[model samples]
Target: MNDALGEPQSVLVLGGSSEIALATVNALPRRRLRRIVLAARPSAARDLAVTTLTAEGISGVTAVDFDARSTESHSVFINEIFDAGDIDIVLLAFGVLGDQEAAEADPALAVEIATTNYTGAVSIGLHVARRLRMQGHGSLVVYSSVAGDRARRSNFIYGSTKAGLDAFAQGLGDALHGTGAHVLVVRPGMVRTKMSAGMPEAPMTTDANVVADIVVKSLRRGKETVYAPGPLRFVMAGLKSMPRSVFRKLPR
Candidate 1:
């Protein structure tokens, strides 16, 4: 349950090692959080996240093994977590940004991207939503992207996955309306994270902490959708309205 200030007492991060997800957790009121569950693939990165949080004096930090592609086990995995205790917030932060050129060259690679980004999200997202509805009070923060606003030739495969995920999350949010289980869709432009490293910085590129701040603020304000850096919302709107011919001419 959330505290008097409406701060979440417990957070469940599906992509525990995600820099943006971890930043959002760190930005929260640490003193009020009773539990922090980092669910991700078994790896040193997941272990490091727990160790880092523990070092920050955040108690009850635990790590659980979670593979996004393993949709068959999502039901059981989510059930086990919810059975342990109530989860105030669930961050659907797991995704893979495969090499766009490689994905275009290999149909199998494209499938991998779709599986991890779209299929896996739908698998876990529904399970999380069901649990949240049962508890009757919680928020689901989904990490969408500006690229999804309109697919670009530069990264259409990845963009298509995000576009599907964005629509699915919005519909899920609507389905959960008045159920006390809400969803916040976060669309950020190119973010400066390990995932985007080596990529050319876009016009309004920002960092993970900046996006984290927007997420926390939006959660408190009960916003349904938010664009990090604030201005990206307007920017995306303009881009979305552009003719495909003009859009294609735009820089990569």
Candidate 2:
């Protein structure tokens, strides 16, 4: 539940070790935060995240085992958490950026990327929405990407999954209309993170903190969709306007 100031007290992060998700949690008013649940496959990184948050003075920080690809476990996973107490905010931030060339050569690899990003999301996202609607008030932050706005030949395989997730999030938001629950879809360009390491920084590439700031602001203002760095909103608009013939010829 949220505090008197509407600041969230209990938060759930699906991609527990995600830099953007952690940064957003940091950006929130920590004074009101009481419980934090980080759901991810067990790893030293997950343990480190819990320890780091606790060391930083955040209370009730804990981690639970989760696998995004395990769709059958989603219902029980979500039910166990919501049954314990109300969740004020949920961050759906797990995704993968597959190697386009490799994925094209191996259909199985493409299937792995698609199932993790699209099918897993749909399975878990619906369960979360049901719990939120029952509780009557909460926010769900879905991390999409500018890559989803239009597919590029460079990473079209990964981009296609984000596009599917973005569409699903929009439809979910509409389904929750008139219910107190809210959904905020975030589209970020290249973010400088370990997942994106070794890639050349694209125009308007920002860090996790910048994306986190946007998430916090968008949540407060009740925006349905937002772009990280803010300016990329226009950049994407221009990209989308480009004709396919011209768009495909541009540098990767």
Clash statistics: count for each candidate: 0, 0
What local distance difference test score does each model get? Answer: 0.93, 0.92
Off by over 4 Å in 1: none
Please state the error at residue 239 of candidate 2 in Å: 0.5
By lDDT, the best candidate is 1
Clashing pairs in 2: none
Residue-level lDDT tens digits of model 1 in 1-252: 977687788999999999999999988876688799999988888899899888988888999999999999999999999999999999999998999999888999999999999999999999999999999999999999998989999999999999999999999999999999999999999999999999999989999999999999998888999999899989999999999899999999
TM-score (C-alpha) between model 2 and the true structure:
0.98
Model 1: which residue pairs collide? none
